[model samples]
Target: MNKWEILNHAETACYQEEREVLVRGDRRWITALHYAFQDDNYLYLAMDYCVGGDLLTLLGKFGDHIPEEMAQFYLAEIVMAIDSVHKLGYVHRDIKPDNILLTADGHVKLGDFGSCLRLQEDGMVHSSLAVGTPDYLSPEILRALESREGYGPECDWWALGICAFEMLFGSTPFYAESLPETYGKILHFQEHFEFPPLAAAVSAEGRSLIQGLICEPQERLGAGGALDFWGHPFFSGVHWATLHHCTPPYQPTVSNGTDTSNFDVVDDCLSRMEALSGMRGSQPAGAHLAFVGYSYMATGETKDCSRDTVMSTDKQQSGDSEGLIRDNLLTESVSEELPKPFEHHLVLSKGPAGHVHGDDTDLDAAMTMELHRQLQEAEQRSRGLEEEIRQLQGELESLRARRLTELNIHEPHLFLPAHRLDATGDGKLAPPACHYPLVIRLHRHLLLFHRVWRPGVTGESYLLVCAAGVELQAWSRQQSAELS
Candidate 1:
C-alpha cells in the first residue's frame, strides 16, 4: 500500500544501474533498458543520470520560464533523443519535465522509460489509467490510461510539444480544477496563451514549430516527419548533427567522472533493447501478422497496397497537446479572439504543385477584430449543437451495429444507418417471433476479424466477434431466466 518506498527504491535502483552503463552513449541515450529480477515485482532501470537532476528541480530553482538560449538548446537536444528512441521502434509514453534531467555540465539528458513500450509492437489506442504528470500529457494520453490499445508514434510527439511549451511559458496551456475537467478541456481542444510574454521572447518560426509539434497526432509530425520540423527556419543557425555527436554537452553532476563501479549491471540491462531492435527484422518467412486494425498501417496489411502508398487514413493535427481531435471551429474562433501575431495560420506548402492557401489579410485590423468576435460567438453556439448531434449519431450507429451483429444479418444494405429499421415500437413491423430465432451469416472466406465494440447507457461493451463466425441461435435472457 505504501507506494513511496516502492517508488524510491525503484528510482534509486534505476539511477544507480544507469550510471554504470556507458558504451557509445549513457543511459539517457538508451531509451529502453530492460532489467528484471528473480522476485519480478518491479524492474531495475540503469538509465542516463544527469547530475543536475530533473526539470522539475530546475524549474523550482529558476522558475518555470527558462532562458531563450538554454530553452532552444534543451528543446533541440530532446528532439534528437526522441528521434533516436523512435528509430529503435519504441515510444517513451511518459514524457514530462520530471523525466528530463540536466547534467552538471548544463546539457539536457532525457531519462525515465519505465512506462516506455515498443509502440510498433504494442498497438494501443489510449489508457484509462493515467500515467505521467498531468501538465505534460498529450490530450489523448490525458484521457486514455497508458494502456489504451491504439495510439502510434504521434503520441510521443504530442508530449514533446507540451515540454517545449512549458520551457517557453511558465504555465501549461491546458489546466483545470480536476483531472476530468482538464481531460474535457483537452478533448474539446480548449487551450489559450497570452501574447505579451512568450511572443516577445520567442521567434515566429520557433512558435510555428511548437504549433506543428503540439497538434493532434494525425495533424502532428510523424517520427520521420520531425526531421523537417527541426530543419525549418526556427533552427536555421542550429547544427543538430554536431550536437548529437557530443557525448556529454555538459559535465555530469556526479563528483567522480571516472566512476565505473556500477557499469556491469547497467550495461547488461541496456543490451536487451539492442537485442529487441535486432530481432524485429528476423521474423520467420510467411510469418502470420496479427490484425489489430486497418487504421494502424504498420500492424495490419492490405494486399493491393504499395509500400510507400499505404497511407494512413488518420492525419495528425498540429498544436494538439492531448493527441485528441479538435473542433475545426475551435481553432478559428480562438484565432479570431487573439491578436494578429497570435492568429492561427495554415501551415501550407508553396509552389504550383504544393499545398497553397491564402491568408485572410484583406480585411482591416479593426474589421478583422470585429469579424473574429462574431466568429467566436457563432462557433461556440455551433460547437454546442454539433456536440449533441455527434453524440446522437454515435448512439444510432452503435445501435445499428449491435442489431446487425447480434442478429448475424448478412445484408450490407441493412447495415446502412439511413435505411436501418426502427425497432422502437414506432409501428414498425416486428419480425415473426420464433424459437431460437435470429438468423446470422458471415463470409467464411474472409478470415480477417476485428474487435466489435458497443457503448451502452451504463458503459462501453466489447466483444471480439470473428469475421466468419456468426451466432446461429440466440438463448434469450428470458430463456436463461427460465432455466435458472
Candidate 2:
C-alpha cells in the first residue's frame, strides 16, 4: 500500500488509543488523555489539553535538567504510575521523557502505553518480548531477545531509574553514540556507568537510590514492589503518598480549554485534521479507515467494554469538538477525566550523588570509583554464566511439568509464580488453583486456562499452561507433543 493508504489504517494512532484506554485510564495524574471521537481518516482522542507541554519540552525549557525539586516531584508521580499499572497487570514497555507530560501546575503524568503488555491472569505474563526505548531498557530487556525469558515488573523500575538519572544529569546514565555502545554500557553498567562531576552536588541518598534501581535485575531495588522502594533512604523524609498534593515547581500560562500553545505537534495535527469532516469536500465521506469502534475513545452512546465502535456507529452527541472535549471531562460514559494534582511536600533540595563509600568528600570519591571498579569485575565474571544456567533450568522445568501433565498427576509441591498465586496457610503462595478446562472473560478479552504440574520447591517458579482462548484442547495437545 502507498504511504497515504497505510497512514489511514489507524494502527499508529490507535496504539495511543488502546494503551490509554486499557492502562492510563487508571485514574491518576501522571498519564495521558483519552479517546474523543473519530472520522474516516482520523481517530480523535478526548485527552486533556496539557497547556504546559510534555516532559521533554519542559526539560528543554529548564536547560536540559529540571530543578532537583521538580525532578523529584515528577519522578515520584511516574514511579507511582508504573507501580499502579504493574498492579493492574499491565506492563508499559515504553517509558521515557517523550511520553511524559506536564499540566498547568507542573504536575507530571506519563502517557502512551501503546507498547504495553497485559499480563494474563493465568500467571503467564512472562514474555519473550523485548520492546522499548533503548535508552530506558533494563539489562534483562536489553538482552531479552537473546535468551527469551521473563523480566516482570522489574524492567519498569530500570527505565524509571534512567529517567531519574536524566532528571539530574540532563542525559541518560549510560547513553552513547550508537545502539551497540549503549547496550554495552548497560550490560557492563557497574564499570562503564559513573556519575558525572555535575552529579556530585546531588545528595548521596538520592544517588544511591537511582543506583539501586538501575542494577542487575536480581540486585535491582524494589524487590518487594513499590512499597519497599518507597522506604529507601533516598526518599527519606519525603512524603510519597502525598507528593501529588504538592504545588508544582512551574505552572504554565494558558487560559482557554482548547489552547495548543505549548504543544506544536498538536497544533499542526489539528490544522491537518480540519479536512476530517470534509469541510471542503476534497475527500470522500465513505473513503476512510479510522473508525470510532476500531479506535479507542468516548462515543456518547456506543462506549462499552467490548469496544463496539464502528463507522456506522452513530455519534452520541452533536458533531462538535467542544462537545467531545466536554465529554472527556464531565461525561459519565467515558472512563477517564481531567487529572487533578494532590497535596503534599512544599519544598525539596537536590541530593548529593554517592555516599556508599563513606562521607561526601573528595577522598570518598576515589573510594567510590574503586568500589565501582571492583563491582564491575565481579559482574563480568558472572555475566555469561547466568544465561547458561537459566537455559538449563528452563529446560528442566518444562520436562518436569510436561511429565506430570502427561501422567495426570498432581504435584502439590509445584507452584506457579508467587505474584500469580493466592496466599494461604502461613502466608505462602504457590499453586494458584482454579478449575481447569475453563474459559473466562477478563475486562473484555477471553482467556483459556490450563495448569502446569511439576515437582518444585520454591512454590513461585511454576507455570500454569494457560493461554489466550485460541483453542484450549488443541494448544494443550501441541504442548504435550513437544515434551513427548
Candidate 3:
C-alpha cells in the first residue's frame, strides 16, 4: 500500500477500537462518542467538545498544582471514570493528565482511549508494549515487557497515584530526564519516591492516599473497584454516589458551549504523523471487513446537531485566511478520491430506533459540493505559487545578465588570452601553441561567463563563437600572406 493507504488503514483500526470502547453510550465521567463514520480516506469521530479543555491545561492555569480539595474533586471523578472502563473489561493503558478532560462546569471526563485494550478470560492483558506516559507507567508494566508476562487493571491505579502526586506536589513521583532512569525510579520507588519538603502544605491524608495508590500492584487502592477509595480521609466529605451532581471546587470561565479559551491553541493545522511501516504492501483480502460493524448514532439526535453551529462559530472567530487554509488542507486530504463519487454505508446502527432520522442523501451532496469548491480554491492557490516561483527565476536570470553586461563593458581584456592563432599551409586556422598557457585561462573565463550569464545557452553556442573568432583571424592571416 502507498503511504496514504497505510495511514488510512492504521487509523481505521484505531478508530474501530476506540469506537468499540466508547459505543457503550454516555457515561457521566467518560467523554461520550456521539457518532462515527469513515469516508474513502478519513475517519470521523464526533465526540463531546469539552469547553474547559484537558486537565493538563487546567493545571497550567493553576501554576501546575491545585489545592488538595480541588485535586480531590477532580481525582474522585477520574476514579469513577477508570472504574467504569474496568467494569466494561477494558484497561485504559495510557492514563495521564492530558487525557483527562474537563467540562465547562469543571467536572472531569476521561478521554483519548486509543491505547485501550480488552482483557482476556484471565482478567489480564498480555501485550509487551509499555503503552503509557513514561512517569506514570507502573513497574509491573515494564516488567511485563521484559518477562513477557501479563498485567491487570492495577497498572491504572499506579498511574492514578502519579496523577495524585502531580496534582498535589506539582510533579510526578518517578520522573527523570531519561526513560531508563524513570523506569528505574518506578521499579525501585521505595528509594526514589518521596514527598518533597516544599509539599508541606499537602495534608497527611492526601499523602496517605498517594502512598496507597503508588504501592505494589497487589496492594493498590482500586484493586477492588472505585468503591475502595470511598473511606480514604482525602475524600472524607465527597459523596461518591452523587459526585457528578454535586458542585465542583472550581468552575472554568467559558462564554459559550464551544468556547476553547481554556485550551492552548497549539497549531492551525493537523499533525502530519509518519505512516506505519508494517502496512506497506498489498492489503490482505477482506481487510476492509474489519471495520464493517463500526457505525453508531446516539439516541434522540436527528443529526449532528452541533456540527453546523460549531463550524459557523469557528468561522466567525478565526481569521478568513486561516479558515481558508484549514479548509483547503482538509479538502486536499480527501482529494485523492475526488474522481469517484463518495459513498458511506452504515453497516451497524445503535439507539432505540436502530436508525437515524432525516435524509442523509442531501447531507452527503452538500458535503461533496463544499469539498469540490475547496479543492478548486486549493488548485488556484497552487497555480499562483507556481507563477510566483517562475517570476522569481526570470528576475534572477535578468540580474545575472545585467552583471555580465557590466563585466564585459569594463573588463573586456578578461575574455582575451595573450596568444595568437597560427595558420596552416592550406590557410585554415590552427590551434594556439601549447606554450601560450593564457589560452587555457581565456577558456576558463569564457565558461564561467557562459554559465553565470546564460545558463540556458549550450556549449555548442560557445564553440560557434570561438569558431567565428578563429575564422576572422585566419582570413586576416591569408590577406597578410597574399600582400607578402
Whole-model Cα lDDT per candidate? 0.48, 0.58, 0.67
Rank order by TM-score, top first?
3, 2, 1
2 or 3, greater by lDDT: 3
* Residue-level lDDT tens digits of model 1 in 1-484: 1122333334322222222221122233333223322111222333223334566656655577676666666777777666655655556677787777554344555676545555434554334445556666676765455445466767777777777777777667676789777666666664543333547677776677778877777778654543555346655544443443233333323333233321222346523222222334653342222111111112232111111111110222223232121222122233332223323432222324322232443223544676788799889999999999999999999999987675543322221111113546364433322111223344343232232223333322222223433332233333444555
Predicted structure 1, TM vs. truth: 0.45
For model 2, residues 1-484, the per-residue Cα lDDT tens digits are 1223334543332254354444334545444434545544444445554556788777777888877777766777787777767766666778898887765445666676666766666532455555678889888865666776666677888888888888888899888899999889888888987889987878886698788888887888755566555556665545554455556667655444444565646535434333444443555444544342445554444332112111111232235332232233333322132111211112232245422221233333553565687789879878878888999999999999986555432233322233343344254544543334333322234443365434543343223444454354454556556656
Alpha-carbon TM-score of each model against the true structure: 0.45, 0.53, 0.59
Model 3: lowest-lDDT 10 consecutive positions: 433-442
Runs of candidate 2 with Cα error greater than 4 angstroms are 1-24, 30-43, 121-130, 261-484
**What is the lDDT ranking, best to worst?**
3, 2, 1
Model 1 residue 8 CA deviation in Å: 18
Query: Which numbered prediction scores highest in TM-score against the true structure?
Result: 3
